[model samples]
Structures are given as C-alpha cells and as structure tokens.
Target: MRRGRDEQGQVSLLIIGFAGVIAMVIAVVVDASAAYLQRSGLDTLADGAALHGADLGATGEDVYTGGLPEERLALTEPAVRAAVGDYLRRVGAHRSYPGLTFTVAVDGAESVTVRISAPLDLPLRFPGSPADTTVSATGSAVSTVD
Candidate 1:
C-alpha cells in the first residue's frame, strides 16, 4: 500500500517535468520562427535597396556617342552608397525597423551590394539563450549599360 501511494505521485512528477520541457521547446520554436521571418524580411529589403542603387548607378553613367565609343558606364562607390541611403530613407525602412542598420558598397565597377542587419526581440527568454538575436542579409545588383 505504501509503495502504491509513492508510485502514484511519481507519475504526477513525471507529467509535470514533461510539461515543462514541452513548454520550453515551444518557446524555442516560436523564437526561432520569429528570427527566421525577420531574416527573410531583411533579405528582401536588402535586395530592393541593392537593385535601386544599381539602377541609379546605371542612370548616372554617361553614354558616350549614344551607346557608342565603348559606352562609358561605371558604378562609383559614393554614388552607390548615396543611392542605397536614399532608397532606404524613401522606403521608410529605418522607421519600420527601429533596430535596423545597413551598409552599402560598390562591388567592382558594375555591381552594387547592400548588407542589412537588425536585432530581433524574443518574447520568451530561455536560460543560456540570448534575449535579442541579430539577423543579417546581403544583396547585390549589377548595372547594365544596355
């Protein structure tokens, strides 16, 4: 009779432990999903910014002889950076993501690249896990004279 009573409480303890583990697992999954979605959004923003910068670079090029004389087209570093900054500002990306930070660079003479990063806040914090996670994304676009 004593052993039966002790075993009855053991199952209850096991159930409680299992429930706690399940809750932690759920928290982890939810946080991870949120981070993934944030990263995806950042990537899309970077791609759009990069494309806009590249288009600006293309427009800034001087077509010698109207697409003749080797079609002098070039993407300067300053121009690319300025274009990316303007695009971000115009699209209100900074306002949308308060923690967002980005960098723009001209990749070679014909391509522009943008790297975007943002921090994601987790609803639930687990032991040994960070409360905020940083997500980063990069995008590149090529300028074409024709």
Candidate 2:
C-alpha cells in the first residue's frame, strides 16, 4: 500500500521533468529562428546597398558615346563608399539595428562589396550558452555597363 502511494507521486515528478525539457526545446527553437531571420535581414540590406553602389556612374562622363565607355562605367572606391553610406543612411539601417557595423569597398574595377554585422540577443538563457550572438552578411554587385 505504501509502495503504491510512493509511485503515485513519482509520476508527477517525471511529468514536471518532461515539461521542463519541452520548454527548453521550444526556447531553443524560437531563439534560433529569430537569429536566422535577423541574419537574412542583414543580408538583404547589404545586397541592396551594394547594388546601389554599383549602379552609380562615374562623375563627369559623356553619355553621348556610341558605346559604353570604361571611364563612365568604372567603379571608384570613393564613389562606391559614398553611395553605400548614402543608401544605408536613407534606409535608416543603423537605427533599425542598434550597434550595427558595416564596411564598404570596391571589390574590383567594376564591382562593389558591402558587409554588415550586428549582434542578436537570445530570448532565453541556458547554461554555457552565449547571451548574444553575432550575425554578419556580405554582398557584392558588379557594374554591367562596361
């Protein structure tokens, strides 16, 4: 009779443990999904900035040329950087992602590259798990006018 009574409450403990495990799994899934979405957003922003930079034509160029001139289509480092900065500012990317950092550079004579990075805070805390994770993405665009 005492053994049966002891076993009756044991199931409750087992149920509680199982519930804890399930909760932890759910937390992990939610946090992971959030991080993935944040990364995707950063990637999209970088791609847009890079494409905008690549589309900027060189200054003081003659559009009357029968064929596309290399000088007009060239991607300069200063021009690429300026275009990328302007785009980021216009879109308020820094305001959207606080503590975000980015870099813009000319990948080649006709290509622009942009890299953006931000930190994501996890929704749940766990033993030995980082409180925040760094997410970064790089995008490149090539000028086709040449």
Candidate 3:
C-alpha cells in the first residue's frame, strides 16, 4: 500500500522531464534557422561579386579583340574591383556574426570567370563538433567579337 502511494508522483516527474526536452529541441530549431539565413545572405553577396568580376573580364577581352571601345577596357579592372569591394563591405557590415571572410578570384580572357567565396559559421551542432560553412558563387561571360 505504501509503494502504490509513492507511484502517483512519478507521472508528474516524467511530464516535467519531457517538457525540458521539448524546450531544448525548440532552441536547436531556432539556432539552425538563424544559421541558414546567414548562409543564404553570404551566398547572395558572393554571386554579386562574381557577376561584377565577370563583366570586367568580358570588357578586357573585348578590348583585346577590338570589339569594344578602348576606354571601356581601361576602366574595366578598377570598376570591377570597386564594385566587388563595395559589395563585400556592405554585406560584412550588415552581419553581426563573427568569423566571416570573402575571397575573390578573376580569370579567363575571351570567356571570363569570376569566383567568390564567403565563409560562415553554423550553429546547433552535435557536442564537440565544428560549425563552419562556405558559400561560393561563380559567374562567367564571353566577350562579343567585332
């Protein structure tokens, strides 16, 4: 009879334990969503930078082939660098996250290729796990020949 009376309290204790587990699950969900949004933003920034670089590359190629005005070639690299730099600065400043960096690379002549990499930090991982992510975008364009 004594043991049966103590058993009544076990149900409430089990419910309380289950509630704590639910709360932790919700926290993990929120952290994962935040990390995903940040990564998407970084990817957009990379895409913009790559497009700008590709435009510059195309202009340079056109100049070499006498397809575009000579002045356009002269202005190409500086303008592209400016645009990419500005984009990086804008995106970086907008985020309050830590450990973010953008790397840019431009290549190709007639067909120009621009590559941008933006590093991000992910959240809500298993215990003792590293959370780092990189979002990359590339844009390519070919110069029109005269």
Candidate 4:
C-alpha cells in the first residue's frame, strides 16, 4: 500500500514529459517543411531568371549580321545582369518575396547562373531552432547553337 501511494503520480509525470517531446518534434517538422517549400519556390524563380538572361544576353547584334555561332553562344556579364533584372521586375519577384536578393553571372562565356536568396519565417520554432532563416537557390543555363 505504501509503495502504490508513492508511485501514484509517476505515470502522469511520464505522460507530461512525452507530451513535451512530441510538441518539440512537431515544431521541428513544421519549420523544416516550411524551409523546404521556400527553397523550392526560390529554385523556380532562379531558373526562370537564368533562362531569360541566357536567351537575351547570349545573343549580340553581331549574331544577326554574322548569323548564329558554329559553337556555343557568347554570354556577356553586363547584358546578363540587365536581362536578369528585367525578368525579376517583369515577373513581380520583389512583390512575391520580401527581402529577396539575387545575383547574375556569365559563366565561361557560354552559360549564365542566377543565385537567389529570400528570408523565410518558420511556422514553428523549437528551443534550439530559429524562427527566421534565409533560404537560397541557384540556377544556371547554357546556350548552345544547336
């Protein structure tokens, strides 16, 4: 009888601890899912921007006069930067994602790369996790005469 009385509330304590652990796990899952979704969206945006840049920047007026190249198209940094900026504004990227930042680079005179970053607010946060984080994505496109 004495032992039973002493252990009366032990199960309740165990249940409470389990409940806490469950809540933390749920929080972690929710935050991680949110981050993954954000990254996916950014990936799409970056791909579009890179493709647009490659299409417009890889061509020069000489292409019209001289005809399409026998090899890979030549990519220019200035032209790619301008084209990327234009695409972002045309697609309303800034309006879609707050605190979004991006960079465009001409790679090896044949391809263009776009890297984008955006701030994400996690739906839930655990004790060791952050409520806010930055998610990034990179996209590249190569121009071939074929």
Give lDDT per model, in order. Answer: 0.81, 0.80, 0.55, 0.88
Q: What's model 1's overall lDDT?
A: 0.81
- The per-candidate count of clashes, in order, stands at 0, 0, 0, 0
Q: lDDT: which is higher, 1 or 2?
A: 1
Using Cα atoms with residue i matched to residue i, what is each candidate's TM-score against the true structure? Answer: 0.86, 0.82, 0.57, 0.88
Worst 10 residues of 4 by lDDT: 1-10
lDDT for position 139 in model 4: 98
Q: Least accurate stretch of 10 residues (summed lDDT) in model 1?
A: 63-72
> Model 1: how far is 127 from its true place, Å?
1.2
For residues 19-133, could you state the per-residue lDDT of candidate 4 as single tens digits? 9999998988888898898899999999999999998987767567767778888878888899998999999988988899999888798899999999988887767786569
Best by lDDT: 4
The candidate that achieves the highest TM-score relative to the unseen native structure: 4
Q: On TM-score, who's better, 3 or 4?
A: 4
What is the full ranking by lDDT, best candidate first? 4, 1, 2, 3
Residue-level lDDT of model 1, residues 68-114, one tens digit each, is: 22443577777778888898899888887788898888866778889
